[model samples]
Target: MTSASVPLSGPRFQTEPAELYRELRRDHGAVVPVSLDGDIPAWLVLGYRELHQVTGDPVLFSRDPDLWNQWPGIPDDWPMLPVIGRKQSSILYTVGERHRVRAAMISDALEAVDPFELRGHAEKFADELIDAVSGKGEADLIGDYAALLPVRVLATLYGFTDEQGPGLVTALNDMLNRTADALAGKQHLAASMGQLLADRKVTPGNDVVSRMLATALALEAEGSGSGFTDEEIVQDLVVMFAAGHQPTADWMGNSLRLMLTDDRFAASLFGGRNSVAEAMNEVLWEATPSQNLVGRWASRDTQLGGRRIRTGDLLILGLQGANSDPQVRTDGSALTGGNSAHFSFGHGAHRCPFPAQEIAEIIARTGIEVVLDRLPDIDLAVPAESLPWRPSPWLRSLTELPVHFAPTPPLEATSA
Candidate 1:
């Protein structure tokens, strides 16, 4: 596998991934053997139907990390352990009937979020974020606004205090930043979640975490819930925390980048509210937040996308690759004008639960709308092509989206 594999790391993965994906498709066809950080081998599923088939049949391509064949070679301290999920007991690793119950609990908890209230929270946080920078004519949208908005909103939804938002952000940044302190940051986040779960147990509120606890209890009362430990609940909360923040933040950042850079959305950035949604949808197709998902293990030897995948083989879902699959998207036309056949949110039973998708949409769209509304005349500070992207194979996100807008007073001074 190492002989034919390409290491899935480089500037190409960041700055010009679509071109890289195209190249991989030409050379490796749909199922490309790729190497992770430690030269560990995995198959990247690049075909649209193949990715669909893999995700759809969870039984065949199981989420259980224990099934991975490379476990013996994986170092205990491997950096990829978190991503590949070594011995994960969370919902992401759950399989079969238990996965269904857990997914339902998560969906119900998120679904109970009041749409109007959710929008209100999004607006509140978005306005606050813009206010922090509105007084300056220049701002890095990624760091100052987009990176900060989703987590703040999510923290509120999950019952974290305004005071705790900064801590959560710090923890998440440290964890994903992949620095020497990454493990410490991850441990801190897990501790915080465990504490929150303990607090919710004592006095549950109308928030997502509390709601999850209540739902679990209700399901157990009805004999519909799988018995899971508080530790597992904490892990699931951490999953929700990580999943909800960065991707949605990138969704906002990427959408804003599109609007600022593309002529089709330039006018829309001013006051055209409708094009905000259009640009966001377009980003999901072209620059999806999640580029690849650390993925399923083959339940048995099987052929996929012309490659023979052996039992216990790891398969990464090449989301952007599948979305841009030439077989399905032959026209070469942009999917911007609301063609959502893209695999951005994934597919099948384990796909992002529909309710979670709605929350992300609300946070992302609302965040983008607030930015455009606040900085009505904003423009990119640097050449669009010169902007650098974060170097991570899993996510397609900008390092910084620098922009200049007319300096204005903070929103609070002008609002009630």
Candidate 2:
């Protein structure tokens, strides 16, 4: 399968891909052959159970890009190089002992964040963003609100000042989108993180970076050998921004779109018949933020979901497809009732570490709820079909979410 023969990215799958997914499941079971950029063939895992099996057994299906069969032969100018290239030191690219060490460091750093305070902060950001457009009675929610909230909140948590927020957000967007500017965006991100780390070393503060640096120093003092290097710290910061900022932004956009389009959900949520939490779960089950996770390379020859996966074969988990599997639930109602058996946040060691009660869910819910609270009458400016989405295989983000709402007065104070 070559790139010219088939389309594997999210844009091709955006037009009601359920039928395609169902057909793939029927013809190929859970795992199907698909082409990524440059016609790179990979296994697309679409079954919920199969995702668990593969991600759970990381030894068989490794996260290391070095194990990919085409890594060596792939040219430097390959379009997918920015995403598939193994040039960074992210825990997302590691496995086994190395993965454990990095995961521990990240977990420890996140421990300092108070979930309740984080929720308040997220809400505050949401309100300020909304206020920027609320008085106009119309705004592009994606640009004016959804896209700004998460990055701003994350920047603050990472100890980035207001001046650095826009640059960080731009770099994150370019890097995650894998555009022509991806390499430049990566360089910008590295330089910014390097400067931040240097400053923290000299004068540490109570932010995620400072916490991580302190932890790395303590671990080095114990001669653990697992201590984080400067490069590793930078990589981890990139991962955090990539993982926390964009995905959360996508979730906000997807959830808002769902709430506006789905009559059942829109009525219930806006009418106060259903909670934001319930609506969020429903949206997550239906339109997951991360549609396909970062590809996992097969470490050795193995059979998965009745498909032959050779050593070095790339496996891309179809997160949204798996969550929509008929075997999971008949409809979104089950999701609203708290049957969150979706692979949206994934599973196994690579599962998102943000706990359900805290970080991820709280941030997303608060972001949405605050908007609804500020602009109760907000509605789509155009038909749902007119809205555009980001064209990437890994995420379900909107290009822009234009919305209109009743003009309202801004709050007296913007501080959280």
Structural similarity to truth (TM-score) of each candidate? 0.96, 0.91
The CA lDDT at 259 in model 2 is: 81
True lDDT of residue 251, candidate 2? 80
lDDT of 1 by residue, 98-166 (tens): 999899888988999998999999999889888888988989999898878888888899998989988
Report, for all candidates in order, the number of backbone clashes. Answer: 0, 1
List ranges where model 1 is wrong by over 4 Å.
1-3, 222-225
Residue 222 of model 2, lDDT score = 89
Query: Each model's C-alpha lDDT?
Result: 0.88, 0.78
- The deviation in Å at residue 211 for candidate 2 is 1.3
Which structure among the candidates has the greatest lDDT?
1
Candidate 2 lDDT score at position 2 = 20
Among these predictions, the greatest TM-score belongs to 1
